[model samples]
Structures are given as structure tokens and as C-alpha cells.
Target: MTQRIIKLGEGYGDVFELFTLMEAMPDRVDRLLALHTIKNDEERTSLACIFKPTNQGNFHPIYICLEGIPKPNDQRNKRYEMFKALSEQFDKPIVEFTVPPSETYHEEEQYFQQIIAVLRLNHLLPPI
Candidate 1:
């Protein structure tokens, strides 16, 4: 299968925007993955969420969130919690990463490259 990488930005409410987009194209999603960046290095706060395709014909939408979730040093992160809850509700694992942000790259493109790299490294994405 040919996999396409999409870059998401952090606008006023990009999370909500992403949700709305996925809701609109539920069937097109083969899997959902997310990467959330944290602020501090104490606990290592990067996270990745994955959604797998089911036999029941349900949609699998991956969400890769970066620079969104606040660090534990600050107030609790509702957005991170929400993604966690959603994963639990859908029986998916909220995978975590602890890598630094991409260097000398635009936010959106960098995010896309990161996700695609992860998928390829994990053998989740077929050679294209």
C-alpha cells in the first residue's frame, strides 16, 4: 500500500481542526498515530498514539501531535489526557517518544518527516 504523510500545524485550535477533518473522512484512515512533544527532560514527555484497522470496518485515524502537550512542569495537560482517553476508549496504546525536535526545519514539514520516519523504521509503512 502507498502511504501518504500529512503535516499538521499548531493553529489556534488545530487539535479540534484535526478531529473535524478525520470525522469528515473517517473511512480513508488506515491507522492513526500521534507524537506529542513535552517541555522538560525530567520525565521525557514525547508521546505517539496509534490506531489500527479493525475487522469490523471501523476507521483508523492516526494523530501525530508535536509541541502541543505541555510539560509536567506546568499545569496538567488536558489535550494529552484527551488523546489518552480516546486511545483507551478505542483500545489503542498512547506510544511515547523522547527525541528532540527536528533541526533547521519548518514546523509542519519537520513533523511530517518525523512521523514518516518513525513509521518506516517500525516497518509499519511499506517501501514506496
Candidate 2:
């Protein structure tokens, strides 16, 4: 199986679109993830929607709104609230954890690889 991170943007206006797609295709939705991290001394989160492998191809796509939302425990946010509600509606608990700051990586691809590995180890993503 092949897995890839399809970044939408940092959690901003793009998160609403992620919610819409999740509502539209519940069947394709595999998991909801919240990656918590401390960047510049502020707690932040990255929300992601993992889709099941494609029917014809072994392509597992993980749609993400990269680190932008504030962690509820740190600071409540409307965007994060919506995601929490959406997860409840889908009956899937959000899988969350801390990861290295994105700035630690020299390239976006490197950052994605780190996230992908974390997902795979947690059994959230298929192995390569």
C-alpha cells in the first residue's frame, strides 16, 4: 500500500472544506487525527482526515490542514471545536499526539514523511 499526505493548507478557511468532504463521504473517511506540537512556545494542532485506500488502487490519501489550530487545552478555538463536533458525529475519536515542529524540517516533504511515519506506526496509515 502507498500512502501520501495531501495538504489542504494550515487550518484556516481550508478546514471547513475538510469538514464538508468528511460529511459528504463518511464511508471513505478512515480516521481523524490531531497532531499537537509546541511551536515558538505556543501549543498548536494540525487536523487531518485519513481516507481509506482507493477501490482500484492501493492509494491511501491523508488530507490535512497543517498546524494552525490552537489545542483546546491550551486555548479554545472555534475551528477546533467544529472538528471535535464533527468527530463526535462520525463516531470516531480523534487520534492525537505531539510531533516535531515543522520548522525542524528543511522541506515540506520531510515534514510529511515524519507525519506519515507517525501515522503508520500508530496503525492509522497503511505501510509502504
Candidate 3:
């Protein structure tokens, strides 16, 4: 099974696209995640949804809206509210955790690899 992060964009307006993808394929939805981090001295969150691998290709895609929304604990935002609503709508709890800021990595790929590692360690994603 191959797992990959499909970045939608920074949470800004791209968040709606993530919602559309989830709503359009609710059955394939596996998990919802809230990755929190402090960037530039501000607490932020990245919203992501993991989808089950396709039957034919076994390609597991993790769709994400990278750090753009304010951390709910620090300040509530409409985007975060929408994400919570989706979690309730899908009957899936939001698996949230604090992570090192993306800036910690020299490349975007490295950052994603760290996230994948965390997921596998927690049994959120299947181990290799």
C-alpha cells in the first residue's frame, strides 16, 4: 500500500475544496486530522482527511489544508468550525496532535514524511 499526502493548499480558501472532496466521497473517508503547530509565534492548525486506498491501485491519499487556520484553543474560526461539523457528520472523531512546524524541514517532502511516521506509529495508518 502506498500512502501520499495530496496538499490542497494552505487552508485559506482551499479548505472548501477539501470539504468537497470529503462530501463527494464520504464512504472512502478513513480519518479526519487536526495538526496543530506554532508558526511565527501564532498557534495554527492544518486540517486533513485520510481516504482509504483505492481497490484497484491501493493508493491511499491524504488530503490536507496546510497550516492556515488558527488553533481552536487559541482562537475559534469558521473554517475550524466547519471541520468539526464534518467530523460529526461523518461520525469520525478528529484525531488531533501537536507537530513541529513545517519550517522545521528544509523541504516539504520531509515534513510529510514526519507526519506519515507519526500516523503509522499511532496505528492511524497501516505500518509498512
Which candidate number has the best TM-score?
3
**Cα lDDT tens digits for candidate 3, 15-97:** 99999999999999999999999999989899999999999988989999999788887466889899999999999999999
| Each model's total of backbone clashes | 8, 0, 0
Q: Cα deviation of 119 in candidate 1 (Å)?
A: 1.8
Stretches of candidate 1 exceeding 4 Å from the true structure: 21-65, 72-74, 106-111
Model 2 residue 35 lDDT score? 89
Q: What does candidate 3 score in Cα RMSD to the true structure?
A: 1.0
Candidate 1 local lDDT, 77-127, one digit each (tens):
665576566556555464444455543257656656666677778776544
Candidate 3 Cα outliers beyond 4 Å, as residue runs: none
Deviation (Å) of 69 in candidate 2: 1.0
Which is the winner by TM-score between candidate 2 and candidate 3? 3
Q: In model 2, what lDDT does residue 106 have?
A: 100
lDDT of 2 at 81: 88
- Residue 37's lDDT within candidate 3 is 97
Q: Score every model by TM-score.
A: 0.58, 0.92, 0.96
**Arrange candidates by lDDT, highest first: which order?**
3, 2, 1
| Clashes, model 3 | 0
For candidate 2, what is the total of clashing residue pairs?
0
Candidate 2 on 29-120: residue-level lDDT in tens? 88999988888898888899998888888888899888867777845689988998989988889998888888889999999998898887
RMSD of each: 5.5, 1.4, 1.0
Candidates arranged by TM-score, highest first: 3, 2, 1
Tell how far residue 128 is off in model 1, in angstroms: 3.5
